[model samples]
Target: MNIYAHFSSIIARHLAALVAAGELPAGLEGYGFTVEPPRDPSHGDLATNVAMVLAKPAGSNPRAIADKLAGLLRAEPDVTAVDVAGPGFINIRLRDDFIRARVPEILREGTDYGNSALGSGQKFNVEYVSANPTGPMHVGHCRGAVFGDALATLLVKAGYDVTREYYINDAGGQVDVLARSAFLRYREALGEDIGEIPQGFYPGDYLKDVGLALVAVFGRTIRAMDEAEWLPIVREFAIEAMMKMIRDDLLALGIKHDVFFSERSLHTDGRVQDALDALKAKGLIYTGVLEPPKGKTPEDWEPRPQTLFKATEFGDDVDRPVQKSDGSWTYFAGDMAYHYDKIQRGFSHMIDVFGADHGGYVKRMQAVVKALSGGEADLDVKIIQLVKLWKNGEPFKMSKRSGSFVTLRDVVDEVGKGVVRFIMLTRKNDAPLDFDFAKVTEQSRDNPVFYVQYAHARVMSVMRKAAEALPGVDLSDAALAGADLGRLIDGSEIALVKMLAYWPKLIESAAVAHEPHRVAFYLYDLASEFHGLWNKGNEDPSLRFLIDGDKDVTLARLALIRAVAVTVASGLAVLGVEPLDEMH
Candidate 1:
């Protein structure tokens, strides 16, 4: 149960009653009223600023309103004490039994304890790792992939209908380069000695398998064909093979997208034209000259008029070109069409996760969506920063030309999926992350993944030991629901329960901010609390889970540990990292 929400609703109802009874003025909005844990535990179990928020509107002093609200709240069976704190803040101390009672509710809810409906069932589209399909994914793509997936899972927990999508850049010059690169590999597969990769061509050996497959399928059939004739066939084959590799690599890290949007499909069967027509109908699309871009305009730039969108009208720094002088659509043109298609498919909330190098593109993209939807659609672009690799305290270098670039598969293979996923998300998306192969694999407290997973594993160990020692003591809901949690009275025991109380609030806040790293940090804090309690038990016999002679006390303590385990499991699941039951 969400205790904060429960108390806020009760306080709001009482205030509304007061307003109706003429004790407080009408038309004073109470939407800003909130119930949150006090900074100091001694102050109260919860605090609310309702009196302060309503004071000016009600034509009353904050302290006066707080005193009146305090009296009203003190009458409730759950509220044991209420004090008017500094300048109208009301501090509430709930009956000890009220807080104790939540233990059973948590046991009943299990892993679903902190699930919330904060999103109100809104439909959201999350596009991440839309990395170009020219080659296998590298370490740089890992963070966004994990972050976006976890964010989608968090949104789902917050009751949003989330669609995880990957936009494939398959219709640009990059793809054409990919086609030519594959052709070289195709020649190499036919025993032709193609020397060092030519300039502007991909030099990785990842396409070797694709070329081998091409030889097996085409079997010299395209030898007599011109580049134009062979280009399409080879490009399609290479793209499919590369995407398969990408999907497999993502799978290795336990990531899967619900949708894979192909940029090429936007231009297929006139879809791009249709999208442009829709924008044109709204008078957002126009053919006009764009002024030379400020700050480092190309020296060879000529002031020729080109077709441009009025992006500046929607808050972009400058109007952006849709078509270039070569009569080809710019990259931004395809992106606009893609987003418009997403809007047409009924997603009013859209999120695009891009690399930090694309930071300058965020405003323009948001402008496009705003202009296209007439401000109805909301677009949030999260730019994930670069990942600096280190191994054994030395900078890890991966160069494609030297054939040493660390592929996604390499990292996954070295550390396994769980470590990779957890470590990737341990940092904020926009902050540069230093991922050391040595540090992450270490089973120490400093390693967050290890610490968190160790907490889960420790809980399981306690359960196993308890089950063996106390035969027939039910760990099931029916039994745990009847737990006498008042038996858990130690300071550390109560502190652990209080930490559990923050799960709902943490979930709501993290989801609201669209920050999955917050979840990672929360899990770290919770793990720290669990570890502290576990360490304390080593010193204080009463704090231990197995109170050797008392079944009720043992069961109560087990119930608390189980609650912690459930919350940890739920948080890790949201991050798509498997909760370990045993640490090896």
Candidate 2:
């Protein structure tokens, strides 16, 4: 029931017939031809660029080709009229009954109406919200979490096998800092009078409970151990605690990953060395000196020969250092191992979502994957920009160092999971987002989440009212399955039905672009149409849903409203937002 696709197929068959009859050249390409809603509805129901695209290849004037195609299209039963406009563009107006009849199909399909097969079983791995396992997730991680989760859902709907992943940075210096910080808390739990946290240690009170738990579990046993022996024990405990906190925060925001890859696992299983050996076999790894970093290299920086990868051969600024002068692997070395691990696991398409601060790291990482896989694997890095927090039009003050930074839990607590999810995706992933606590909670059109939810609620309200008015009218599929939708003849009613027809196309396009914000935008437009039609009923009594003395007309209109609700609910579900049945 994709009306555009259906009509496009008809037009394509007719064009093929013309080509067969020698009216157009044989072996001409028509795959790029598309049937879409006309920019101006008055022009026609749908328009195609086929004639224009084929004119040059057929060695004929575009108007002549358009004229022939128009006549061929006009002969179809579903097409009411066809006209050539704007340099051989064919605009088509379908029979009114054909447009109105789709309402029942929408109601029958429900939320699955817009599901697509565009992905066709491709395997895709989307890794996002891989924030370091050092502390709780904050507002910045919220945007990437929601975007990646919605993207996974969209890809799944489009028939792709998507695996949501989170990469944990539990093996870095940062985790060591976390270990030392937790050890301080452990001592505090053991009744030591530790003063203000040292300059280089974590000072958050969140770890106080971790300390208490450690004391309860180990008592004074860990207190007598040497630093070398106790550091590993404390590191494991700190990482587990921090990861648990992060998982709980994500759960609060309705996000969960299928895989949680640990950086430390690469070292523990000899995978890092194996990955380097694999790349070295391909001549991508070599021992060489990296040029001094440009533009203000630190005064203490010294040029030294070290183990470097031939990143320049694969398109990077310079050969990247894989091992430092101290004979220790750099962060990039472990990252290469991680990607190689992903490729070895048989994922051809991989995506990593990083914060905007990681923009400079993208090309180097892409270069590494390219060199390692010989271009067999593709890696896309999506950088989410910082979120500017606002409350009552003023910037919300919170310091990262003070450890009072607003965690993801704080956001979910303030506005529940649904608002947090929807508001996070209302802006493009790469663009800066201004999230106002006060404005988002306002119940008005200015708040997009509220507006969309209100539209769904309004449709539900109408359904309830209609059911109460017309008892046993059969909203069931068996009764409405053969609905007489021709009675829905109002312009506004047709417009609403036409909007519902675009859902499948919208879902496929949004998935193709990897832009979930488009879903939010489409829902906003659908809600606007629903709201506009609702307001139109105020002026024309006949346009109202519950019409007196007109049972068939009421059923037809009720069917259309149900279709809108179904589509809205489907889109919101993809975005992880609950469709509200009643507005508060």
Candidate 3:
């Protein structure tokens, strides 16, 4: 399935054999070499730098090594010819039968063809879209949500046990503000003539239902209590209500997290204190007076005594404070506890997706994971950049739903979840993404998601047509696996198979890099090639997928097209997009 890996192993085995035969020096073992498709396809089908890597180690000239290696490699049954390219690089051309042999395997596997067992069952916890519970999710949260969810899917395909998580910032002052905002709505529900919402309070109408529910529950009797007494009761209720609306918005976009951890729980259960104590035991906690930031000093900046963490000892620019001068825990303190909680839950690898504005907070967080897990756990934070919405080639105006910034549901309603997820991943996480309604919804070749789906639909159309063109033939996968694939010897047909051969290797490399955007890129490239092949049939009748009299050739081409469709469906699954059977 992984031809690159297969050939790389082949080269390694040959290197060992050469050493055993005294051709290569004994100490030349463990030389690193890479096998990949040549950047220029004209060079060969597969190319490797094995000679260049082992020449110096073996104390032999690279050209001499390549000449001997080429002769041995040409003897492989899977390889048709071997040549030494410039500077002693070995390029091996696979036999057409070797490429065609994989077609039946792809047809039989369906979407499971590219699944890898690279992780060996290691656990990974990905935390993203941890939007504050003070309000509904806005468009700012869309990229992280899609990126993290897609990444979790990619990890699962790579054989890692993935748990998607969302961290709630409910214990902060923002939730207190939320409680007050709901109380104002509570008064509004009671028919009180409250004027316009004052400044420093959330003015959104999302809390109107919460107010009515509060009235229905306890009526006005609960309003007479002091603010201190009533704040806790309202805070608890508002958080639950806000989280429900947030969860609903996520569901609209087909995002669901396995865990929703609360920062409040850390305080209530003494986890924060325990985490700080753990750091102190390692001599990473300290008391100090910090200096002002170089250029971002607040107007009220002053050197004050505070409890700080030894963040600089691990790699941070400066030590970070864990507690304020008022003796209250800082947000970073809660964050440290959150990471500790993840390590305690037996997660050896963790990833946090943050907004681009949180870039300065990355190093310290990594330091926390290293300090708490004793360098055993690694935390990688992917900063998601801004997304600018566009329609009709102009900047999109306001959202009619919230009448302010666009909400995640607003975009989903405008374009379906498939378009939203696919377009969000069109660019890297740290790069700006342009979500254009006009371009994304277009049914032309320029639209990647649409083009990919159209390929799948086209494959279905051909299958139905092929059944009618070639009567009394078994076209099922089990039957096709036994077809005379040796008839598929066209250069274009062989090229398609070579592309499909890269899927398993692509999945493994992309998963290893923690870059899910690569999946979108691969799917786009695969679709482009398939579409080009589909168009070629209009000019060359022999290249067409179905033939009137040639049943054998037609069946072979149909098998090739089926493998393309199956591979596209498999790639789209990793991106969390459903491949359509038919497009309206």
Candidate 4:
């Protein structure tokens, strides 16, 4: 029951009637208007700006159009009142009984209540957590991992065919450093006195296990090879081991990707050159000398001709380099081939979740998709901000096991997976978040995860008490839905129903904006409303879910609370959070 959509269609019909009657200008369909909940609830249940939106186009006064539209809405079913406010805003109020009647519909839908068909089965690719395959995943990667996973789940719920992917940065120079680090461990395993790790080497003890494994497989044969011969072999072995550790760590957090694309494969199979050749065909490839970058000059800056792509022709600030002066493919060339591969695989929409440090890379990547697909495809990039670690309000130190950064496993092992996932989403993707160990685990209303979970658990507790207090009373959802809901005359009861009805619209808007943190904010507000109603019953004994010797009233209140539970559970599922049935 999408109440917002229902009213929107009604308003559209009335506007069409005015257009046919010659009271308003024709071609009113071109005007874009919005139907949404009013910021102040006392204004009305739903408000529309259709009259204001069409006033300029139709060459008529806004209030006059609003007055005519209000009269038409007043004759509709269940619309009790319509008011034309300042500047021709139409606020429509529905009958309270009409809102109460939606409880049964919510009970039947359960967790599927807020499901939407906004995407209409369009294929979408969400690429995130593409961390370098050189060591274990750090706490910085945790934010992007959870954000991407939850966003993918939200798109799926909104009816998009989503593919969660992880891109491996194995072809970079970082992996070569990892290979050299593992070689040091390999020498130490062979009973040699390996001194302190040099300036550029990784110093984590985790590589000691990799060294031992290499000895088990290649034995003494690797010792006789030169640096050039052993670099590639050790690089391959080290990358595979590090990726396994990464996969295990992600599994601990309940994150699994559908695709793990290798950057090295793009170079090995000639896709990089193939992508450049395709650009050359479009006349976008050329030899040009770029000016010095903004601010200071780079160390490798030189005034020479380089192969470049016409990135500025699309939307980027300047043209980008596709090949360096040394006749080697640049990093941007690999990215173009990767996206071309995605375009070939039939994805019209793509979302990239990047770290905070990659802010400068957004414009060029978007330009690449637009140029390559000839405006047939679109790309959206979300930059995830950093997460600060705190223990009882003091900054936490880094983990020695990870050499320099705190591993994702250390955070998950300290608190469970659900807590980490929920807390990470409490802030928007572009805003920095502070994850404190002391505050998140506290059993209080200040803790949003616990507050929301307690609301679900409290409803379950109420059901248990209903079974004991009123024996053979049929406390199931079906029986509750069939109860005399007219007995629910309180303002709080009707407010909850309105909140529950807004779930479908919330899902649609959040999915459209590609913002998943809105779900966390909505859940917190819903839980607060439910908790407020529960506390109201504490003062007035008659407002409680279970009233002595009053079966009809008790069942009516039970239906109201059960509807709240269903909506909360449905929202949590979209955020990849499990609603708790009991608090420990």
Per-residue alpha-carbon lDDT of model 3 for 13-98, expressed as tens digits?
A: 88888889988889765667889999999888899999999888888889999998998899999988899988999999998888
Each prediction's RMSD to truth: 2.0, 2.3, 1.9, 1.5
Q: Count the backbone clashes (under 3 Å) in each candidate.
A: 0, 0, 0, 0
Best by TM-score: 4
| Tens-place lDDT digits, model 1, residues 1-584 | 78898888888888888889898988875358778989888998899999888888899998988888888899999888999888888999887677778778888888888899888899999999988888888888888888899999999998899999999999988988989999999899999999998999888888888889999999898867899999999999999998998999899989899999999989885776776677778787777766656665677567776667778889888888887777788888899899989998999999999998899999889998998888999999999998888988899765452154667777888788888888888998899999998899898998999999999999999999988998887777558768788898887778778788888988888888899988889899999999998899899877899888898898888888888888999899988988999988
Give each model a TM-score: 0.96, 0.94, 0.96, 0.97
Candidate 3, number of clashes: 0
Q: Give per-residue lDDT, candidate 4, residue 340.
A: 87
Clashing residue pairs for model 2:
none
Global lDDT of each candidate: 0.87, 0.87, 0.90, 0.92
lDDT of 2 at 50: 86
Overall local distance difference test of candidate 1? 0.87
Flag regions of model 1 displaced more than 4 Å. Answer: 55-60, 297-300, 398-404
* Ten contiguous residues with the weakest lDDT in model 1: 397-406
Clashing pairs in 4: none
- For model 4, residues 342-387, the per-residue Cα lDDT tens digits are 9989998999999999999999999989888889999999999999
